[model samples]
Target chain A: MIQVEGLTKYYGALAAIRDLTFAIDRGEVIGFLGLNGAGKSTALRVLGCVLLPTSGRVTIDGFDVVRDPHEIRKRIGFLPDTPPLYTEMTVGAYLEFVARLRGVPSGRAKARTIEVEERTATRDVHDEVIGNLSHGFKQRIGIAQALVHNPKLLILDEPTSGLDPVQIVEMRQLIKGLKGEHTILLSSHILSEISQTCDRLLVIQGGEIVGQGSEQELATQMGSGGYLEIEIGGPSQGEGRAPVEKALQAVRAVAGVLSASVIREEAHVAQIKLDAPAALCPQVVRALVAADIDVMRVGRGSAQLESIFLKLTQTGGQPS
Target chain B: MSATFLIARRELGAYLRSMIGWVIIAGVLAVDGLLFNAFALGGGDKRSSEVLSLFFYFSSGTTMIASVLIAFRLLAEERQTGTINLLYSSPIRDGEIVLGKFLSALAFLAIVTLATGFMPMLVMIHGKVSYGHVAGGYFGLLLLGSATLAIGTFGSALTRSQVLAAILSACMVVAMLVAWLLGRITERPLSEVFSNLSLHGLHFQPFQAGIVHLRDVVYYLAVTYVALFAATRVLEARRWR
Candidate 1:
């Protein structure tokens, strides 16, 4: 539903975003991942038709952003990092106003407002003034306004930025529910917050797209292999270092095991790290058990994606 | 045009609901009444025509200042509060946003300006003043208010700070008000140019004297149109920045 080529934006002599190229298919939820000042907002603003790119072309649903921004505006709903809300207006009235502003006929504006309010779970506060609502409700109102007109695409910049943990979970579910009805593009600095909610991830750093793919695809591409974390207890007490050394050697001998090391040793228990695909984890565990190392726990490491993200961003996706 | 009216209606509703709008109306009316009692009606004996003219004269100052205050928040406050993104991302044109804001302020200013009609009616009650004179004076105030409000809209478009918008608008209005003074110092052709450019000195005198000139009407409208156009351009330029 969206395609961008060489999208560059410059404020005076400094470039905010440079040479950004990506395409988003219909019915897909894409997460734009970047740290603060990583040009994520600038890129999204350009795509939202709020700012014009200094160079490059962007088209949404076959309409050019620069030449046909009005057409694009009618088809896309955008919620900026700070929700564009009129504090004096009631939630219902504000949603109705936004509905009409985006070309929803006046006759149907109220119905559309109610529909969006229901979707965003803001129905109870329909009559409440926005300024009086809590931050979580205010964010929901922001999402409601974006979808009030039922646009083809939704551009949300950091939808969960200031929310508390419970609010964040609610927001995640709300966004997840929005999938299939509209193509969603949301940005976030926190990987775990958006990783599960999005179908694909676009990692950006220094105004450039360093990597793009699903979580596992990005992990496999950046990480030589998945990591395996294993915890084992020795048969006898105070045999700590000997059992850890024996388990590490046995795990390394297994085929497809790239490397192995003892992570930590305490009493008779030792934690070992193995650089091998998760599919070979069973074999590593078997080798450790056959070596008389009592297996307490065996599972895929959780830092696989985290390591990939840090590696891609720090190295700019260059070969290590 | 519907988009323009949609924005205008919302903005006007905002003005009606907020305390600042009512405060401006009350403050301007109080100041207008005080000036009428102290200056227009108080100073010794004078003809009814002179009194009405003086009323228009003082009311013009209040209208100009009130226009600046009313319009300073039109666009600047939207930017300050970050609500401008709603308008910016909508399908509406830049001209529509500018015109919608200007129209709302103009409507509010007209209501406040007309509310001071009792002062003119007081002159009509005691002495003999032509209805034409009242209408002419009011027409001039409206036109002057419209033009200054447009200038204020342009100023508001230039920055996100309402105080800065007010200052910028005051500077523009004062410059045009003092053009006649500038004309007095310069020679011949330059003086004529400056005199013709004056916002109030020459253009408003005919309306103040109970005579509506086509040229004066056109000049006020021309100023309104040009300022509104510049404000629209400023809004459009923001997208590029």
Candidate 2:
């Protein structure tokens, strides 16, 4: 649905984004992960057709962004970091205006507004003034505006930014609901926020694409593989580090285990960081069960993701 | 509807529903009426044409003032609130956006300018007057308003802050208003050029006196076209910026 090559944008002497290249396929939810001021917004702005790239080229749905922006615009919906809302307008009215602005027939714009309001779950506030809406509702309405015209591609920049925790989850669910309907390219500073929602990840740093793949592909590319944290308890898992290591011997002996370490230990419980593919969690748990060790709890190591993100952004995905 | 009208309708709705729009309208009406009563009516024993001319004269000032206030927000507020993104990413031409915004502001300014029509009818109550004079004066006000609003739109396009937009618009309009003064001081062809460029002295006077000269009509229109064209170019240049 999108192709970008050597996309560079400069504000006078300073380059906002430089030599950024990536592609997104139809029906794929792509996450643009980067730290703040890492040029993610600039890259997305180029794709959104809001800003002309200083150099290079971007095409959406087979139309070049520079030469055929109006054609490309008809095929895309964009939500900037801050929702572009006329606060004085009601949700329904705002959506209708956007629908018509995006080239929906005037007769159909109202019905299409209703359709997007329902899809984004903003139907209840259809008549409510947007200025009176909560942050969560405003964000939902923002999504509704983007979806009002039913564009093939949705470019959402920080769609979940500034929302509360619950609102964040709801916004994520809203974006996830849109997965198959439109090819979504969303950006966020947090790794785990979009890690699950995105079918593929493009890690950008310093205005360049430093990494691109699925989450596991990136983890694997980072050379640490996937991390699974296992909590083991029971009398056999003794107090000392030595006993805990001994108790996890069978888990280490699993076919795909690369390394294992007891990260934390208490009287009868231990947290083990296992270096292996997360898909091997079942076999690792089975090995523990066969060894008669209590498998107290298991969770994917999110800390490793933070470290991976840090490494990717800080070292430009060099892993050192 | 076409994108131009679509944008214009929404913008006009905003003006009707928002405080700034009404505030400017009310303010212009109050100022225009005060100037009408105090100067045009207060001056001793003037002819009906003079009274009507005085009405258009003061109305022109208020119209230009209202245009600056009305047009300053056209593009600047969109950028300030980030709503320009919606327009920028839409499948619409920059000229359409500029034209739509200008039309909305013009429509609203017309409403404000025309609301003062009762003042002219007051002239008809106790005085002898030709309806053509009233009509011509109003035509001149609309043309002046259109040209000033177009200039203000260009000013708004140059900046994101409405205050900066107003300042810039006021500066440009003042420069054009004083072009006749500059004409008085310069010599020969340069002076003639300045006089011709005078937004008020050379062009608007003919309409103020009940004569719709083609030269004046064409001049106001040319200014409107040039200013609106400049505003459109500014919008087009923003993406590259």
User: What does candidate 1's lDDT look like per residue over A180-275, in tens digits?
Assistant: 999999999988887989999999999999999988778767756678889888436655378778888899899988898878877767788888
The 10-residue segment of model 2 chain A with minimum total lDDT is A234-243
Model 1 / residue B105 / CA error / Å? 0.7
**DockQ values for all predictions?**
0.76, 0.84
Off-target runs (Cα >4 Å) in candidate 2 are A228-257, A262-273, A279-303
The most accurate candidate by DockQ is 2
Model 2 is docked with a DockQ of 0.84
Candidate 2 residue B171 Cα shift, in angstroms, is 0.2
lDDT of 2 by residue, B118-216 (tens): 999999998999999999999999999999999999999999999999999999999999999999999999999999998899898888888899899
- Best by the lDDT measure: 1
